[model samples]
Target: MWFKNLQIFQLKDTENFSSTDLVTKLPDHPLRECGSQDEFTFGWLPLIRNSEQWSISSDLCMLVRAGKEEKVLPTAVVREELEAKVAEIELVEGRKVGRKEKADLKEELVFSLRPKAFAKRSDIWAYIDLKAKLLVLNSTNAGMTEQLFKLLQTTLGSFPMVPLQATVSPSSIMTDWLVKNDVPASLETGDEVEIQDASEDRAKIRFKSLEPLSEDVTRHLEQGMSVKNLALRWTDKMSFVLNDDLTLKKVKFDDTLKDNAFNDSQGGALSDMDANFALMSLTVRDFFESYKVWFEIQDED
Candidate 1:
């Protein structure tokens, strides 16, 4: 129910699509059971539990899923079957099977096994800040987010999503933080850090959670190595390993943030879903706002 990570994108123009437009186009790509020939399917649905569609609002949230069906007969299995068939052909014809004949046998094996393969589905929830003109994907994987992006382009005739990036990688900022040997306000450095050399070989240095920079970390910086991963805590709200790409990994929110929404003020039987939703939404909304400056500057140019 909570987003673990975000692959952020900003909407380009409001004139191209509207809430009504999304409502009209979304139903055209509803989820369906995978067919024998269907390799993949994409569609959008409700963001909340026990709902069927998106509601018009300042913030537009939707659940989208992509289903893929693949008939993957293992190479080892196919190889064994092919070997047996090749031997059988050789024994019957009094000669070895040619490469072309072996390829044909493999194709036939796949045909026989196609009906037994299983389908796998992956679901991603997305939030569109209609007022702010932003799209937030709840996936850290670029491939998964791009798949959904392409699907939007296919269904809507246009998709204007530029990934949120900074002109300077977060690594540079982290390097500066390390160089100054100073902790920034409202932020505390954790014991974990990764410093890598800027060369083809890319030599690396990793520090454990219980270890401090002390001397080894400083020596790497002196040698012009850059920060690849740094563990940091943001004002007791969450602690995360911030990557050079500005992606947060191993993010954990504090209970104080959760307790406000999941309250039991009325004898432990409170319908606090809306409260939780509001708090989570606000928390996520603030998360974007906190990082927006980093991207906005780069986007402007």
Candidate 2:
């Protein structure tokens, strides 16, 4: 599947690591369904839906999936039940329910409800880019990404990675781009932009479907506000919103590229995935290379 968001990390000393090694180890820790009382569970899953393969590996990239299953026990429902029990006990016993007893009842209520509670499931897609030495995940959620990191570390014994840190602040550079109306030749500004004042008040402004270098955008830059997020098109092949923290949001590959991959697959599910992965990996690798140059990231730090 196409990645929609990016949380990129720099991986060090990966030249000698075998991508197949990671794939082989994934089966040792396949995702377990949540137990009756478990709040949540996380584990590996097949990269392709309904397929047995846990990973799709190539010399340049290895794609994998992690799944999270959680019980959806509503807090309000639990609180309502607890109150009813506490009231019944208080009335039946002709006494007030003690604090400790109330807490105990709530715990019992939650434990009883967990099994019947609806299960929520989601998947996180991540890939190891051997060419770029980057671990990119299609999630911006801190908790989800951390779970992936922890699982990888446990499964492989070592996952030496750190959040991508560039030599220059992205906001600062984006601000300069708007002020000068001089975007890098490889990238073209898109219609959406978010600017925020640096002052403590932190006033933020968002513009949609307008030129990023328009008079209004430049005027905001003139007012001491800097770019917090900006939508950008990369070499006419992909588009995404680049955040100040360097995370990518709203990522999308050009439809032409997607169409080509689909046509090349000749209409089989597994072949489709393979084609998409191959094209996506190559395109993203090129994007990352340009990103490093733009941000002056000479090497992983």
Candidate 3:
């Protein structure tokens, strides 16, 4: 993000002015625009010039054009031939070699520099949301897709014990399989069913029907919900089973869910979803683990 505002400029010299002369006069030039005291004190004019071709080589320094009468200063030298000159200047100034020097040196080489472009938060989030919608629309395997949907619901429900609900039409056998196998169901009387996990074994977990969130919930999420919020909501519903340990153990999404979600969204949102999910899980787990370790250390006598 900081790199976006960066600008580089190269120095231009007449036949009378040598590159060394330009470099020597750099400190006195008025174009220096360091953002902080550190930048001001440590920054240097980067110089770029060639003895052979002055025009093209001189075009290799950085320039910040703020206003009229603001003399251009060199930040770094791009020409390898000028290394000895650079070292000589450094030795003469008795300046220490460090990041500030490096930054200043880098600043000198370009003849012209402009800020880099960056995407806005709104634009990035909109892209992610659209990607999710596209994945849902294009999946070919209805059954697998349905299974994936239920898994998504189970893994990403509001309540850990209760699973999200959806309807399965008689015509949609694939949907029926997905609901029955991928999604856990608890029948009430006739056609009505709910999802719940079985307690026989922790390994053989099942889905449970969760009460649907009101419209207000969706509105609240849309207003300012972050990726962290969504991840936390989903992890809470999944009984905190998604973590680094679980990841390293070769745990994977339910096959039915994977088939459908991947088959449908693989070409779309689901393509890079797994890697993103893994990164998110690892990040959260590491943060919490570090906090816990700190807490334990603090509690030590």
Candidate 4:
């Protein structure tokens, strides 16, 4: 429920449809995990396992889960077994196993082992923030996010979601902010920043324990280095470092989040879990808005 990383998308369809419109359309496209009969499965499912069809709250947030599953048979392991079988067949046949025979044997081995192959699953929690006009996925990987985008499009008829782009480069704004030592009022500068060389190799440097962000960092900034990461606090709610690609890492939610989102475990565990999910959904929305405001202010400046 708590999105560890935010990959934002502008809801291009917002003008024609509202969040309330999704409840009807989304349920039909529930995720189907990959099965023995199928090679792969990827789609949207209710966040809860089998219980709810769609998880929507009064806050205008819609919960849709992205599930991807693939049958995993390690190629190396398969090849080792195949090789041993090929050798035994060659010895019994009193000749080298020909290309066609080896191929057939490999196919047989794969079919024999596939049912025992482990299934790998990737489930990412995602939400559509109707109020913010954004769809945020907890996944940082572009491929998985694109899968969600496709799922949304398939479910809703058309979902024109594009990766967030800013008028001003975040790298430039972050570097300037560091240079001036003028971290924004709502943001408290943390003790790290990552810089990468602008050369062809794109050498990267990560500086930790640089509390004041001075000396070598200032010199590197002067030397045409680009800021690839910046650490900062969002007032009192949380602290995190922003990567060059604008992904979040090492997020630490302050007490406000823990208290509200997780509430003290007084009620039955299931009720508490439900409360946590709701609180987390709302918290994620508020934080996104706050971060957007902060970045937009910088972009404007």
The parts of candidate 2 lying over 4 Å away from their true place are 86-105
In model 4, which runs have C-alpha deviations exceeding 4 angstroms?
18-21, 79-113, 262-301
> Which number leads on lDDT?
2
What does each candidate score in C-alpha RMSD? 4.0, 2.1, 26.4, 4.2
Stretches of candidate 1 off by over 4 Å are 45-108, 264-277, 292-296, 299-301
Count of backbone clashes, every candidate in sequence: 0, 0, 40, 1
Decoy 4 TM-score against native? 0.80
TM-score on alpha carbons, each prediction: 0.78, 0.92, 0.15, 0.80
Worst 10 residues of 4 by lDDT: 292-301
Which pairs clash (backbone N, Cα, C closer than 3 Å) in model 4? 31-44
Candidate number that wins on TM-score, 1 or 4: 4
lDDT of 1 by residue, 1-301 (tens): 3456655667787566766676677767655656665545555544443465343343354334343234455678878888888888899989977888788888887777666666665677666665556676667876667777876887688877776667667777787778777656756788899999999999988988544356778777878998898887777677778788777777767789778656632322223433444455556566666665533434322
Compose the digit string of candidate 3's lDDT tens values, residues 1-301: 0011101111122222233443343344322333322111112222121122111111222121111112223334244524654687679998756766655655554322212211111000000011111111112233433433343233223111111111322213212322233222321111111222223542221222322132333233234321110111122111121111111111222344344445544453323343333333333333333323321312111
Candidates 2 and 3 compared by TM-score, better number: 2
lDDT of 2: 0.89
lDDT of 4 by residue, 4-86 (tens): 67666666656676566667776777667566656567866665665664665537667667788877889999899989998
Best by TM-score: 2
TM-score of 3: 0.15
